[model samples]
Target: MSSSPTEVSGGGVFQDVHIFSQNVNCNYAHVDYVLENLKDSVDVLFFQEPPWRTIRQTVSIALVESDIVMGAPRYPDWLYMVRPPTDECNPCVIAYVHRCLAHLCPSMQWDIIDHWDIFVLSLFTPKGAVNFLNIYSDNAHTAINLLSQEVNMLPAFIYMGGDFNCHSKVWDPAHTLYPLVAQHLLEFASDVRLEWAHSSNPGLTHTLHNPDLASSVIDLVFMGPLSMLSDLPRLDLNCCGPLDHVPISTLVPISEFEIRISRMVILRKSPEESGFLIDITTGLWALNVEDLFSPDTIEVATSAVAEVFSLAWNAHAKEVVITACSKS
Candidate 1:
């Protein structure tokens, strides 16, 4: 999974969506480092074997003591999308979308594909809701088998990637033997109209810690036939950072009409913030609380207060465009 990073030309003019995928090996520190460093550059992140632990405890009605709240790590700049475990098994696949793309209305499609190792994320666009899949198949190929079984029911994902943990000549030229698991994996992908995306820096996607063992290419990414990708995926060998698998990323073009690089926001401690505070204070002062006779009246007053806040925000928020370097 370790390869050197090579500088390639940027994506096409309309290719604004950047996707980064990696296997963190369930390490908290590795996951934290990836999100912290790539938050500014990457639009979406697909992680396999992400750390799932108890973040805190909350009051539980079932038990006398507090219940353990187990989950993945959280970052302010990235919206973490993960499906809760149905039983005791922790989910192996998770995704994160940048806060900048909140307008896209990204959501997890648990109803479509509900599995701990497979995650389906849908991003709403003007054209339609496009889905991306993140998966982690163990040596037994449980996730791949499930996908193959549910091929008819699953959505046509535009982008699908993860660590399949299977070696075949299709993805690894060094591996001459084609195993049964590889055949099933390829067949499943073909049924769903997914094609293998070759990496620019081609090499082993998984490495051994010891010098004696040979490395292998198991982690793979497959893109749907209709995906609007701009270039071949890149294997970032330099950024694996204490992980066995290197990071792979690709750029996808957004529709010209939907390409938005700037957004309006009221920065904290700025003049706009001061004005917003003043306007909110004034609006709250004028709020009519006298009509609290019924629940309907209370709802009306709440709506009025919300409208006032929205008006004030729209009035003072400044429009800021994302810099080109930030997308790099």
Candidate 2:
């Protein structure tokens, strides 16, 4: 249904693809809670202020080998931690892509761009690719300008999820009605073709369970090509253990069947185009009867199957040229 890229869809009921982002103050004393609660619930988990120094303690827990574990080499096998892990003052980000979809997120690599305030984790998806950016910016102004450039050079589907530390009405509905420095963030999201996505359930993401310190929406997700993401529910499990920010999660309805499809196929369905069905019917009709009825060899059956699918597909989709890879 999308013009540029395919829209993520399901058969009326969409399977949720949960993405969790939390600013866990360094030395995440509550890392155990994450292991227990979020271990099987979400597809991806992003944590800021991860326990880089105390990561070695995770070796005590049990985890699968396929899990892309990171953090300290001696740490838990929960996630692939932010590289060059530093202290809380130089806060870093950590991400754990579940083994189930980890293979789909191939070509994972760390990229350091000059003058940019973000740490990028370029990850690929089946249809195309996405940049799972983990940004920590002291000054959002410079970050906004630099991120604009970085996203321009990259492909579509960017999940710039992190603790932006910027406060404004644009993202924080509770932050003062008028924002001074936060307007630049809106411009940044616009420039990068991303839109703010956060939890609908109220309660700020920062400084949770603290009456003295006021909480604000510091953590955020700026994603692109709308409708790809669904509801974001703020998890108020404040007492979950050493977290300063209450975790925010978004539910993305996913279909494994759809994940296996090519992007070209999703974009091929357009209602405005006329003669699409006619073209499909003609193409299938033009197929050789000898090929479809051979019935003996697998090749002939494959051709028949392809033709039958073409007819069915033509009923709802337009004719599109699909490319296949050739191995040497």
Please give the range of 10 consecutive residues that has the lowest summed lDDT in model 1.
1-10
The reply for model 2, stretches above 4 Å from the true place, is 1-16, 54-79, 85-91, 112-117, 139-145, 148-151, 177-180, 208-210, 236-240, 253-328
lDDT string for model 2 (1-328, tens) is 1111113346433233456777666644565467556655666666766665533233324654333434522224344544553342343556666554544453335433533235555444453344456565555445655664453243333456667778877667776443433544654564444577755655566765768877787777766544334445456464346567676665543333121212212132445233555665676676665644543444554545455644554455423332111000
lDDT against the true structure, per candidate, is 0.75, 0.51
TM-scores for candidates 1 onward, in order: 0.70, 0.58
Top model number, TM-score: 1
How much does candidate 2 score in TM-score? Answer: 0.58
Expressed as tens digits, the lDDT of each residue in 1-328 for candidate 1 is: 1111112225422234678889998899888888888876788889999899999999999899999878888999989988787777888999988887777787888888788899988766665566678989998999988986676465555677889988888888888666656766776676455688888778888887888987899888887544535567788887789887888887654443222234355666889999999999999999889979996777577667767876897899776653211221
Quote the positional error of residue 76 for candidate 1 in Å.
1.1
The candidate that achieves the highest lDDT relative to the unseen native structure: 1
